[model samples]
Target: MYEFRELAKDVYAFLQPPLVWYSNAGVIVGDKDVIVVDSLANAAMTKNLLSEIRRVTDKPIRFLINTHSHADHVYTNHLFPEATVITTHSGREQTKANLELQGEHSASYAKFFPEFDFSGGRYTVQDMCFRGTFSLYQGAREVRVIELGAGHSESDVVVYLPSEKIAFCGDVFLKGMPPLPLEGHVSQTIAHYKLLESFEAEVYVPGHGEAGTLAHVRVQREQLERQFERARECFQKGMSYDEALRAFAGDVIPLEFQRVVILASYCEFTGRHPETKDPASQSHMSLIQSVADELRVLLGTKEVDKKVAMSR
Candidate 1:
C-alpha cells in the first residue's frame, strides 16, 4: 500500500517504510510461477510482503533467492518453506554467522531501538548454494544470480533478468544511504559496480531505498570514490578522526553519512576493528573509535560517541 512499484513488466519492488530496517524486496512473476528476491526483517514484515505478492500474482512461489545474507534481507527465509531458498556458499555461511552474531547482540540492540526484532528463533538458512553464478528457469522466463564478491559483506550477489533488462541489486548499490565498507575494501566495491553495470540493465533495484537506473549507480560509485579519497586525505594530514569527522560532517550529506565514511576509513586504515569493542569499557582509544565507527554504520543516527573526544 505504501510505495511498491513495478520496475518492468511483472517485476516489482517493495520499498521499506522508514521505521523498519529501511530495506526493500523484489518480486518477479514468471510465466507460470513466481520468484522472490529477498525476505523482510521478521515474521510480521514477511507476512505483509507475502500479502502484497499475493495481491499482484497468484502463481506459486517456487524459489526464494537471497541477494545476500543480511538479517533484514534473509530473516524471513523460514516463511517460504515451500520455496527453495538460494544463496552463495559464502552467503550461506555468513547468514549462519550473522544469525548467531545478531542473536548475541539483539538484546543490546533492542534496548537501543525497540523496533529491532527477528521473531526470536524464526530464521531459515539457505537450501541451495552456488559458488559464483547460478540461474533459474521458470516456464519461458530466466533469472541470473551472480556473486560480485565480498564487497558489502563476505559474499554479495545480484539478480539479473536478461529479458526484462532489470537488475535486483542488493545493498551493493545503496541510494541515499552511505555505502557500507563492511569488507573493508571500498575499491572492491567499485569493481563490483562495474560488474553490476556489465549486466546492461535499464532498471536497478537496490536492497535499500528507492529503485534507480545505472546513472544513479554511477553517481553513487563516484561518491564512494571521493568519500574514500577524502578519508585518506584527512588521515594523511594527521587529522584526528574527530577533526576529519567535523571537516566533512554535513558538508556533503548528513553527519550520519559522514560518520559512516569516517568509520569505514578508520577501519580500513587501521587494518582491523578497534581492539576494545565495548563502548562503556573506556577501552583503548582505538577500541572506542572502532566501536563508534561500527555503531554509526549500524545505526545511522546523529549520536556521536563523546568518549572519542577524549582521544584528542
Candidate 2:
C-alpha cells in the first residue's frame, strides 16, 4: 500500500511501504504545470499515481524526473506520454541498457515479485539527458534536478525546491532502512550524504519509506559509516566476503540487504567489483534452498506476521 502525503504547501510525497524493491516519489505542483519526481514499478501503481495527481489538481504533467536508472523507478515511464522524461546522461544510458536486459529476462522477475504484473510492460528511457545539473520552472516555481554521481547507482539525482526547502532524495538516502549501494562505492555514498545535508532542507522525500527531516539523513549516514568501518576491519583481517557477511551481526530491518552490502564493501576493499555469478549456472536445488532461506529470514513466519498485523 502507498500514501500520497503533502510535505509542504504544494509539495507531495508518494510514499510506499517499507517493503524491499518498493520506491517513493514526489509531486511539485506549480501555477500552470506539474512535475513528478519519479514513476512507480508497475503499470497499476503508475496509473494510481496519475489518478492521485489528477485528484490534487488538473494541471498537466510537464516533466517526469527519474532519480536513477533502476527498473522500479523507470519501468513505468512509458505511461506518461504527455510528460518529457528527464535524467542524467549515464542514467539514461543505463536505463536503456537495463530495460533491454530486463525485457530479455522478464520471466526471471516473477520468481521474485509475484505481486507485480510486468507482462506487456513497455520500457521508456528519458527524453532529456543532462550531465551535471538542470533546473526548470513551472511558471515561477524552480525545481533543481542535480546529478550526484555514482552513489547508489551509476547516476543518482535529487529534485530540490529552494523556496520550499524540500528535497526528493532518491535511493541514496533511505529512511529507517539500509541503502543498497551495490552498484556504487561506500565512499561516494558518504560524500553524497554530506552534500544532501548541506542543502539544509526542512522536508526530505526519500526513494523508499516515509518522508522525513534532515535528522533521518544524518542517522543513515552515521550508520553507513559505522558499518563500513566494521567491514574495513573484517577486510583487513583477511576475511572472505561470505565470512564478513556472517560476522556483521544485527537484527536490522531487511537483514538480507545488510548481507549484500557487506559483500559489496568487502569487494571494494579488495579492489574488485562484486562478482555477479549467474544463478542459472549453479545447482538449481541449492540455489532454491538459498533463496528460500533468505526469504524465510526476511518475511518471517506466521507468528511474526500475526504480530505485525496486530501492531498495525
Candidate 3:
C-alpha cells in the first residue's frame, strides 16, 4: 500500500509503494480530470497504482508525464491507455535504447524479481516528445516539464508546478541520500544539481523515499560531491574503476548504489562504446549482472525486496 500526501492543493504523491523499486508516483487533480507522473515498475504495480488513483478521484486521467525510461519508472506506459503520455526526445531515445539493451536479459532479472517480469514489458516512448521544455494547461493551472540534460539517468525530466512552488523531481533528487549517477556521464549529475538549485521550490517530491525540501537536496549534493571526489582521487591514482569501486563502503553510499554510480561515472570518464553490440556492451552488462549478483548475496535475497531498498 502507498500513502498519498497532498503536497499542494489537489496534487498528491503516492509515496513508497511495496512493488516499486523504491520509486514514487504523483497525481495532480483538476476540476474535471487528473495528470499523473512516473508510472510504476510493471503491469501488476501499474494496475495497483491505477486502483489507487481511482480511489482518490473520479476524474478522467488526462496526462501521464514520464520522468525517464527506467524500468521502474516507465514500464507501465501501456497501462495508462487513456492518458496522453509525455517525455523528452532524449528521454524517448534512452527509453528505446534501454528496452533494446535490457529486453533480453529481463529473464535474468525475473530470476531475482519474480513479481516483476521485464521480459514482455512494453515500451511507450510517450505520445509526445519535446526537446527542451513543454507546458501543459489544465483548466487554469500550468504544469511545465523541463528536461534536465542528463542526471541519474539520461535526460531526466522534472515536473514543476510554479503555482504551488513544488517540483516533482524524479530520480534527479533522491530524498535521504546521494541519488544514483547512472547516466552515460557522471558530470551530468553535477549540472543536474545546479539546475535543481535554480528551481528554488518550497516542496520537492523525489522518486524514492519521502517528500523533502532544500535541506534534503543539500544533503544530496554534498554526498554526491564526496562520491565524485573519491572517484576522482581514485582516477588520479591510476586505479582501475573496479579498484575504485572496491574502495567504496556502505558509509559513503550503500555498496549497491555506489557500485552503479561508480561504474557509470567511471565508464563515462573512460568512454561508452555505444552499448548496442557485444564486446563493448558486455563490459557494462557484465558489471550490472555482477552488481545484481552482489545485491542478491548482500540482502540474502533470491528476490528483490522493496523494504530493504526503502530503508536505504
Pairs of colliding residues, candidate 2? none
Candidate scoring better on lDDT of 1 and 2: 2
Over 4 Å off, model 2:
250-255, 274-312
Model 2: ten consecutive residues of lowest lDDT:
280-289
Residues 1-312, candidate 3, lDDT per residue (tens digit)? 456788878888877732235478989988888899998765655665777778878999989999988777887788888999888898888787766766564755565455444532566677888888888878788898998877677788999898888889998887743466766567788777777777788988888767988777877877777777788788789877656756886463467667666666667777852222322124544544444455445545634455443333
TM-score for every candidate vs. truth? 0.82, 0.86, 0.82
lDDT of 1 by residue, 37-94 (tens): 9987766667767888899989999999988876678877888878999999998987
Q: Comparing 2 and 3 by TM-score, which wins?
A: 2
CA lDDT scores, all candidates in order: 0.72, 0.75, 0.72
User: For residues 106-185, could you state the per-residue lDDT of candidate 2 as single tens digits?
Assistant: 65567655544664355587899998887898767789889999878888999999989999999888874576665638
Q: How far off is residue 262 in model 3, in Å?
A: 2.4
* Candidates 1 and 2, the one with greater TM-score: 2
In angstroms, give how far residue 85 of model 1 lies from its true place.
Answer: 0.7
